[model samples]
Target: MYYAEGTHEPIIAPATFEQAKERLRKIAQQTANRKKPSRSAFSGLIRCGIICGDCGAFFGSKVWNSTSKYRRVIWRCNNKFKGEHKCETPHLYEETIKTRFVGAFNAILADKDSALENCRLMQSTLTDCSGLDAEIKSLLEEIDVVTELTKRCIAENSQTAQNQEEYAARYNGFVERYEKAKTRVEELHSIKNVRQAQADAIGAFMFEVQELDTLSEFDNKLWLTVIDTVTVHADGRMTFKFQGSTVIDA
Candidate 1:
């Protein structure tokens, strides 16, 4: 709660910081203002982000029979019938999506151990920040070297009479070097933070997937935690892409 703006170097680049804020904003949107009851579990949480392959629009749920005993809901591309070219991708029954997701997940279950191992491997590689640490250190040194040289150039210029054009050119060159080094350092920091975020996501995904011993029914929590998106194609092929880059087609 104290105040210290520039007391120390930032742990992440400004871009990465902005990315974190954007992620938080999306999560808030996904979670906030849910006073109205969600007819489908996937509706409010953005838990089921199914996309249309043809039109690249997210699927939205619609009630089939709001009044009858045999009421049901289906999901289709939001712009399926809006544009000049209608989306050939068919609308999906909610139950069908659930069944297919369960079956596709079971496919991963069939290769569970290997898939888990791969997730661990990727997480391990991502969490390895030593290489980035070394690069950052070297880059910091590069910046410091450039800074000292620029300082010396300015000192020499002030003490002696010299050609103004050459002086300006040399000074500009030092400024460019300093700028490039600083930019590269910030970029490396961003990359390092992005890898760290990916590692954390994979870890969370593995935890959620591993907790499920056997999944016979659709699980909302698991769906929210593990799935990145389900792409519904024109031929009725659905691809479930899970976190950690695991894909299963059904």
Candidate 2:
């Protein structure tokens, strides 16, 4: 006969340490094999990872338990939930936004003409970098002229052929101006490359936008995948803006 450790209940004891360890391991394995509760069984489950249009914030949903049998999932702004700024919008039911997204997506995919037009609009805004080289050439010429003037002023002042104070001031001013202008030119070149990259991304998105066959099959994932943002105005009119696609209101 054996007693449980720190308990008055008597039990059969393992004859050796190895037997005790084996018994404990069996109990642990049984506990490990127990079935976990399924989380997805609830009807009104809240979906997380949704982005807010007004404050550019991400929001999550929580299930609120009540005396009633049914569970209610409330989607609240993450900022307001975290005691940040008080977002005025009421907590939206997950179904409301999901319905709106499905409807909007279906409407967009239904119109082939509109989709093609959107692609055209995006393609039109893409900048041509072919003329960038010529622009840079002109800017370099201007910098050279400014530099020559600054050098001449310095040389004349050193020879005592010009007023020292005025020549020095003028030379320094020109040098500063030339340097600023050259920096701006370099910035423009860099910007051109960035713009080209953005254009390529938009172009790829446009190609996909034009190929969509139907919108009814669109889900939340599809909406997040294609849409950049959806803006709801004060007048209750909401605009669904897509990535590299034009807005076509229904």
Candidate 3:
């Protein structure tokens, strides 16, 4: 293969070309080592997150050699030939799987307008977190009040000689209230973080969509950023799940 510096405009940017070269180099290394099985081109391009929906096992890649012209790469359930009961999932060719992904992704792009609008609608509720902010503020105030009460109780116990049993009870009550309030605050913060993450994920999807008119070929960078999971089932079916929870099937 020859790569010459082109005078005409390049189809891919220089950085993208370098990234593709790196990916190819890594995948070449993976395929060279057959002693300990590594991933195939599909898994390498998409990362190691493919799942077998039938046996709930991870997928593995394999290469079959007949001749130089007839050599092929395929993927199958890792546990298919391991145990008494074999997984029923079918082996998939590398090109077929990649093509299916392109179809699934392009299907989403086909409805890009509606999908962006839907994301915006969902973001309206997820990003508008004034209610959660107010609740967090109220929780923080309660925590502060409980902390002050605990401090006051400890100070009283240290200053005045009181009944040991009564003083212990009062201090314990304040301590328990303070801990409960702190726990509540932590829970509320966790809820807020989840909402923020959802909003951010939707925003990212919208941003990527805005830059695309249509995809004529497979985009490695876009695939990595936009896809979350690719699942294959026993019934010769494939599903692509995007980052923002968009699912397409092949």
Error in Å for residue 87 of model 2: 5.1
Candidate 1, residue 94: lDDT: 77
- Whole-model Cα lDDT per candidate? 0.81, 0.58, 0.73
**C-alpha TM-score for every candidate:** 0.77, 0.54, 0.70
Sort by lDDT, best first.
Answer: 1, 3, 2
Q: Model 1, which residues run further than 4 Å from truth?
A: 1-40, 62-73, 82-84
What is the TM-score of candidate 2?
0.54
Residues 34-135 of candidate 3: C-alpha lDDT, one tens digit per residue: 455544535555436678888878777777884677777778888889889988889888777778877887788889988888878878887676886687
Q: Which candidate is the best by TM-score?
A: 1
Please give the lDDT score for candidate 2.
0.58
Under the 3 Å rule for N, CA and C atoms, how many clashes does model 2 have?
A: 0
The numbered model that scores best in lDDT is 1
Residue pairs with colliding backbones in model 2 are none
What tens digits encode model 1's per-residue C-alpha lDDT throughout 45-94?
44247889998889888888799998988888889889699999998887
- lDDT score, residue 157, model 3? 80
Collision count for each candidate, in order: 0, 0, 0
